[model samples]
Target: MLLMAITVTGASTLTYFVNDSFISGQLSTASSLDTGTKSVQLLAYDTRDSTTLLQVSNLNNKFGDQKLCGVSCSGGGLTDKIPLNGGTEFIMIKIKNNGINSIFLENIKLNNVVHAWDSQTSGIALNTLQDLSSGGSYPHDGTFSIFSESSIIQSTSNEIPNGNTVNLLIKLGSEDDDILLNKGIKVLLNIGNLNPVEFFIDSGGAQ
Candidate 1:
């Protein structure tokens, strides 16, 4: 009877140690996974011409100035503003996913209004937008009004695979001439859960 009792206690202690070791291993694995890194890069282009190109020089060059001159630009030789004949102007954007996992684009929104000449001038509106990448989702209409610190401009189900760069064409609807005339604005564009991208646009005060 004494020998049997001693053997039982030894087995119990071994089982407890084994369970504790397994729990510790799981915690260690989770900690390492939480340290995974995420990175994103953005580039913007003018949709002045029918054929828009995302030049190699502009790829991942967020530090360089990517600008859109509105109505009239003087001497910088910047591309002229695309006409709103269709009541909308298109803005092209490129996003590179440099992360370990795929990025699910939840929404695109305006972060804030950096500038607006007219106090009555609210903000820009959207017509339609989409990711022009292969296997991309269908276009989503962003017909909602956009103001500084306002609600989301559009909701999307687009996904950006890791190590892939995707192009996005955003159709901006023009407001009344009284609102957009001679106005310049700086806007911050937000994509999904990633960092915001800033751009300066000279509206050229067009009527």
Candidate 2:
């Protein structure tokens, strides 16, 4: 039996103001492999374009001047094959918040699974969070079962302050065999806060 792993890295630049803050990040392919005897096919995608690249860079420069924090983000897609029959695979996501303030993650949708995590456990469940062909919310935590060949798992954590991090592990497999697979996975980290800060000028009324 042969196993392969893939890794992807991304970062978010933070901008601060009295109101309405902006957090921008990008996703790109890191590495992959062809585990099969013959070569398998692989594909990757990123939403940023020629113009968006410059825009994001400029935004980073602009935010560098203010009192802001940085986030080191990384994630990726995965797939694997079993020997005789097909087995299971898994992908893990680690989110670390090194900022001075707390951050919230809202509406995080991956492949299509949704859940919530915190700085402590980072949202790990005994049973896998699978999709239902009948259509439903899907289980957030606890034991559950599904009968889908493929699934997209995701979890959201809010108010993560400095020195805090979250970890998410996604597993795919059958009852017989399971492999820890991490490949072509996509990750998006939306870092921002909604709290308002007041500032007073030396010789101004409210400007």
Candidate whose lDDT is highest: 1
In angstroms, the error of model 2 at 35 is 39
- Residue-level lDDT of model 1, residues 11-79, one tens digit each, is 999999999999999998765543222355654443333322233211111111222322232123322
Q: What is candidate 2's lDDT per residue for 78-147, written digit by digit as tens? A: 1122111111222233444454445554423233333233223223222222222222122222112111
The Cα RMSD of model 1 versus the native structure comes to 13.9
TM-scores of all candidate predictions against the true structure = 0.37, 0.26
What residue runs in model 1 are displaced by over 4 Å at the alpha carbon?
A: 1-38, 47-85, 110-156, 174-207
Model 1, residue 93: what's the lDDT? 50
lDDT, residue 155, candidate 1: 27
Ten-residue region with minimum lDDT total, candidate 1:
56-65
Q: Residue 206 deviation, candidate 1, in Å?
A: 20
Error of 1 at 194 (Å): 7.9
